[model samples]
Structures are given as C-alpha cells and as structure tokens.
Target chain A: MARVVVDVMPKPEILDPQGKAVTGALQRLGFAGLAVRQGKRFEIEVDGEVTDERLDEIRRAAETLLANTVIETFAVSVETQEQAAAQGQPA
Target chain B: MARVVVDVMPKPEILDPQGKAVTGALQRLGFAGLAVRQGKRFEIEVDGEVTDERLDEIRRAAETLLANTVIETFAVSVETQEQAAAQGQPA
Candidate 1:
C-alpha cells in the first residue's frame, strides 16, 4: 500500500486563531520562547499500482480539495515502507 | 529547543467535508481502492531549558488548545537530533 501525506498551513501573514490561542497558552505555561502554528495534515491510502503517475493525481487532489487555494500552502509526499527504509529516515 | 507536534482528526462518524472532497477526487483519479481522511497538525517550538516538567505543560496545552476535546484524538512526541541519531544507529 502507498500512503500519501499532505500538510497544509496558512501563510505566515494570515491570522491563525488556533495558533494564537496555543501561543497564548504556551506563554502562560512558562514556555516564553515557543512559537506555535496550526495547520492541517491529510493521510490518503491507496492500493494497486503505486506509481509516480498515481502520485501526481493525488497531489492534484490535495491542491484542489485537501488544501485551501486561497491562503494556505501545502506539501505532498508519497511514501511506502520500502521507500522509508531506502532514503533518509523520517523526522 | 524542543518541538511538539499535535495531529487532530475527526471522529469516524463525523462528516469530514475536506475528506469527502478528497475521497471523491481519489475515486475519480482511479484510486478506487484508496481511503482518504483529512485532519490537522500543529507544530510548536520552544526554547530555554526543556525538561520533563516543561513537556507536561506543553502536553496540557495541546490537549486544551491544540486539540478539540470532543471528537479528535492526538499523539505527542518530543524529539531532538541527538535522539534521532542515537535511535538511527541501531544499538
């Protein structure tokens, strides 16, 4: 199976209410030096023929539906267990 | 510095409009065997002596502000380069 992960985040200038709330909480918790940002992640699992061609389709889907075209920027990744074991380890 | 990441996803029964849209797109893209879900991720970075006690405070912040106490479940992790390198070396 192939998993496509998409992460979407609001532009730095866009006011993120959720992020602001967390920032305030962090400050209250004595983490005076933390910067927080709220964003979105979507996990899509696909079976049968995981190819670069298929990934392009999913990437387009993320851009059109999973992410807001107006104020958010997104990153897309298509991964498999073998791929994970092959390249740089995930953070 | 330490970073905390919180991921939030709707309950299975909850209507995920973003997810639904992605599902539709995937189906159209010929990924008939795939299931898609949409969710949120928040990244927080803090400076000034990180400790176990500080981590507890951040966990609470994630529960309170980073996640909706109602329908979403979240996972928290504290990681650093040294830890990653140690883990990667495979003892």
Candidate 2:
C-alpha cells in the first residue's frame, strides 16, 4: 500500500474569505503574519504499489474532482509509510 | 518571510462523510484506491524570521483555531521560500 497526499488550493488571484477570517483571528490572538490561504488536503491510502500510471490517475482525480480547476490548483505527493510514521501519523 | 503549512485531519475513529463521498466519486470516475480522507490545509506566510517561539505560536494557532481538537488533529511544517519555489509554489 502507498499513501498519497494531495493539496488543493485556490489560485492566488482569487479571494479566500476563510483564510482572511483566520488571518484576522490570528491577529486578534496576537500572531502577526503576512497572509493565510486555506485549502483542502486529501490523504489517500491505496492498495498495491504506487506506479507512474497511478500517480497520473491521482493527478486526474485531483483535477477533476478534488479541485475546481478554474479557480484552484493542486499538488500531489507520495508519502512512504516510514515517513508517515515519523510524522506520528498512521498510514 | 516564511510559509507554514498546517494540515488538519479528522481522527481516525471519526467518520469522514466528505471523504467517503470523494472516494465514491473517484471510483465512479474509474480511479481505484483503498480509502480517501479529506482535511484542511492552511498556507500561512508570516513576516520576520521563523524562530522556535514563532513555531510555538503557529502550533498554538493550529490548536486553538485551525483544528478542532475534539475530532481533528493537525501537523505543522515550516517551508522555506526556496523549497516552495522548488515545489512550483509562490511563498
């Protein structure tokens, strides 16, 4: 099995009200920052090995369903079980 | 400036209906996998240097505002602009 992480974020040009709200909350909480952009993250646990073809399939999934391509972009990363464990997460 | 990524995910014991919906969508779209879990990702660009104190503050932000501790857990990563650029993202 393999674990894949997909991060879906809005285009920088688009306004992110949720992010802006969090930014405001952070400021009220005494943490100053440049900006905050909120997005979606998907952690997929797949059966079998992760091949190049599978990676392409995952990209398609991101483009077609995981993200709204017109206003959002996504990046995909394959994570090893060991790496997930090191991060204190079960894969 | 530094870009910090906070990934907030539901606890394994908690049910993720959104993830289940996405999983069904993916299978319907002809993509096969074991399971899919969805969560939130925050990309925060902060001013000044990223010190340990600042990292703690980010953690606090994550704990207090970014994640609902009762049902979700979050992980934080500090990314350098160079690293973000390498990943083809603007920091």
Candidate 3:
C-alpha cells in the first residue's frame, strides 16, 4: 500500500486562534521565542500504486473536503518507504 | 528565523472517528479504495538559529504540551529553504 500525506494549513494572512493559544500556553510554561501555527494532517493509505491520475484525484479530494480554500491551503505528498520506516511503520 | 514542524499523530491502534467519517465521505463522493488517518501539524517559527539544545527544548515542549504521549506520537523536523520555497513562502 502506498501512503499519501495531505497537510492543510491556514493561509498566512489568516488568524489562527488555536495556534495563538498554544503559543501563549508555551510561553507561560517558559518555552519562549516560539511562534506556532496549528494545522491538519491526513495520512491516506491507497490500495494500489499511486499513478498521476490517482494523485490528481487525491488533490481534488483535498481541495473539496480536506481544506477550506478561502482560509486554508493544502499540500499533498506520497510517503516513501524510508519515511514510513523512520516513522516506525513496517516498510 | 527557522521553521520547525511538529507532527502529532494518534497511535495506529487507536480509533479515529474523524478519519473514518472522512473516509466514508470520500467513498461516498466516488473516491474509493482509500483509508485515512487524521492528525495535527504545528509550524513553529523560531526566533534565531536552531541549535541542538534548542531542538531538545522543542522536543520537551512537544512532549509536555503538543502531544498526549499516552495516545499520540510526535515527530519534529526543521523545514529546509527548498521546502519553504516550494510552499510559496519566501526562502
């Protein structure tokens, strides 16, 4: 199975309240000099090889359901075997 | 400034209702043969250079505040200039 990763992040111009709260909490806990923006990550397991058409379909899925295009942007990447192994998954 | 990305994901055996819903939704939408697991991604902008000690500190912070170790796992990595440029950010 091939795994694809889709990351959805708020637009740079958008205000991320969740990220702001975490930043404040971190600062209160003495972790300083850090600014954070929180987003979503989706790991998709595909049944077969990832062809260009499959990737395009995944991109469309990301655009339609995974991200709010007006306020967020999404990026899709296929995970390599090495990456999967690094993450402690069976390669 | 340096950017560090922290990804927190649920343990593989854990139930992911959100992901299940999305998977069902996608299948219903005619995107088939795919399974998805959802997680969180944090983009942290550091004030200065990222030294080893700083990386350790961030790891601690991730353990303490960013991830619930009982049910989730986290990984930290520094974003390269090439990745930033690919993402349409000023490198």
Top-lDDT structure, candidate number = 3
What is the TM-score, restricted to chain A, for candidate 1? 0.80
B9-73 in candidate 2: lDDT tens per residue?
Answer: 99889999999999998999988764899999999997888888888888888888999989987
Tens digits of per-residue lDDT for model 3, A1-91:
9999998889899999999999999999999999999999899999999999999999999988988888998888889998766665211
Estimate the TM-score of every prediction.
Answer: 0.67, 0.92, 0.95
Which residue pairs collide in model 2, if any? none
What does the lDDT read for residue A41 in candidate 3?
89
Q: Candidate 3 chain B: minimum summed lDDT over ten consecutive residues — where?
A: B82-91
Query: What is the iRMS for every candidate structure?
Result: 9.4, 3.8, 4.0
Candidate 2 residue A70 C-alpha distance from true site, Å:
1.0
Superior candidate under lDDT, 1 versus 3 = 3
Considering lDDT, where higher is better, how would the candidates rank from best to worst? 3, 2, 1
TM-score of predicted structure 1: 0.67
The deviation in Å at residue B59 for candidate 1 is 2.0
| Model 2 chain B: lowest-lDDT 10 consecutive positions | B82-91
Q: How good is the docking of model 2, by CAPRI class?
A: medium
Please name the candidate that would achieve the greatest TM-score relative to the true structure: 3
The per-model DockQ list reads 0.30, 0.55, 0.55
- Tell me the spans in candidate 3 whose CA falls farther than 4 Å from its real position: A89-91, B89-91
| lDDT of the candidates, in the order given | 0.69, 0.84, 0.88
